[model samples]
Target: MFCSGCGQALAAGQPVCPQCGRPVAAPPPPAVPNLAFEVANYANRVRALSTVWFIYGGLSLALGIVGLAFANSFLNGGGFWMHGPWAHGNFPFGPGFGSAIIHFAWVMVVLRSGLALVAGWGLMERAPWGRVVAIVAAFLSILKIPLGTALAIWTLVTLLGYRNTSLYDQL
Candidate 1:
């Protein structure tokens, strides 16, 4: 190292310059942090969130299937139609209106489930677009109430919280 005051070459760990009597300033310590631990924590959280998303997606898919089955039964002269006045084609909304509504509802359910599944897959695979897809899914799931709301909040916090941008970039 070179002395700052005298510009003379100095031996390592020498406190003072021999010729100039100038004290050598110690270099400042590096600002090191426990990055490995923090990264591990973030990784675990992401894995857990991905698992939750998979579960939520599976449940939503099942629910959609059940709803579609019910709708099919209703339209095929079963379920509510077996006892309701609508059995005689006396529906107030006119023919096929209820069917259209049911179709729309089931389609929405399927779409939402598909999005959740895709988000979970992306996260689990650590894809380049995973974070963005997961954020979008979390926002969409926020209004689902109870389990979905909790998952959404957790996901948002874990993925978007302080220092998470760097952590995700490392991933």
Candidate 2:
């Protein structure tokens, strides 16, 4: 027999070409993927991610609120040694240290929840800004351990693809 790809002579039962290493047998036809279906699927995935963003945002907001509630006890003179004269030495900022901590917690709560809410809305509506917000969220999410890391990686992969970008543009 002959290798159809390179036209090299081959033994009747040879599986591949000796000259070019091409398969002697004909290769199956390449499968043609459905473009429209793929685009629709991408859209669906974006929508699904939107839901996830909302969930994450809500969780962050709740946690932030909880943290804020407990910040005073944790940072201030309410816990152990809080009543001691050395408390001032322990916290150079003194009485204001606890307030500073509360402020910081509030900032975190606002920032994290705000970004998540914005990203979720944008993604759901397929707004141009949504992609930008999503990217930012992905980067920030990486700082969170475990679940956040996984979500961030998936978000980056899903939103950063060339085809996905084109798909977003169309949405």
Candidate 3:
């Protein structure tokens, strides 16, 4: 090694340069910030978010299926409330209007359910596109209110929070 002070050639582990008597300063150790806690926190949040997504998707799917069945029953004249003399004549919106609305609602429910399911799957699998899909789904879910709104906000914060972007990239 060469001494920094006098540029003198020194043997290994020398304490000082013999020519100039300059003490050898060992290089400082590389700085390595500990990220174990942050990583674990983010990982837990991701798992929880994905779990919530799955539960929400399942519930939505069930609700959509039930809604479809009810709509089918109503349209087919099988619902007791939709029968009798006042069924068709007393209806305010007239025929087929309610059916159209129900159809639209069921379709929306199915779409939302599908989106939630896909987001959950992507997140659980740690797919490259998972973050994007989850963000999109979270934005869409923000209007759902109560549980959905809370989940959406949490998801947004976890995935897009400061310093989280790089951590997720490592995953």
Q: Best by lDDT, which number?
A: 1
Residues 89-128, model 1: lDDT tens digits: 4467887766787778888998899999999998888786
What is the number of backbone collisions in each predicted candidate, taken in the order shown? Answer: 0, 0, 0
Best of the candidates, TM-score? 2
Clashes of 1: 0
lDDT of 2 by residue, 1-171 (tens): 788888888986778899999877765798877777788889999999989989989988998888777766556646664665535335666767667778887987899889988999999999999999999998998979986787788889889978889988977
Can you give the TM-score per candidate against the true fold? Answer: 0.72, 0.73, 0.68
Residue 110's lDDT in candidate 3: 87
Among all windows of 10 consecutive residues in model 1, the one with the lowest summed lDDT is 72-81
Q: How does candidate 3 score on lDDT? A: 0.83
lDDT of 3 by residue, 64-94 (tens): 8997887766664545577664364344667
Ranked candidates (TM-score, high to low): 2, 1, 3
Error of 2 at 23 (Å): 27
TM-score of 2: 0.73
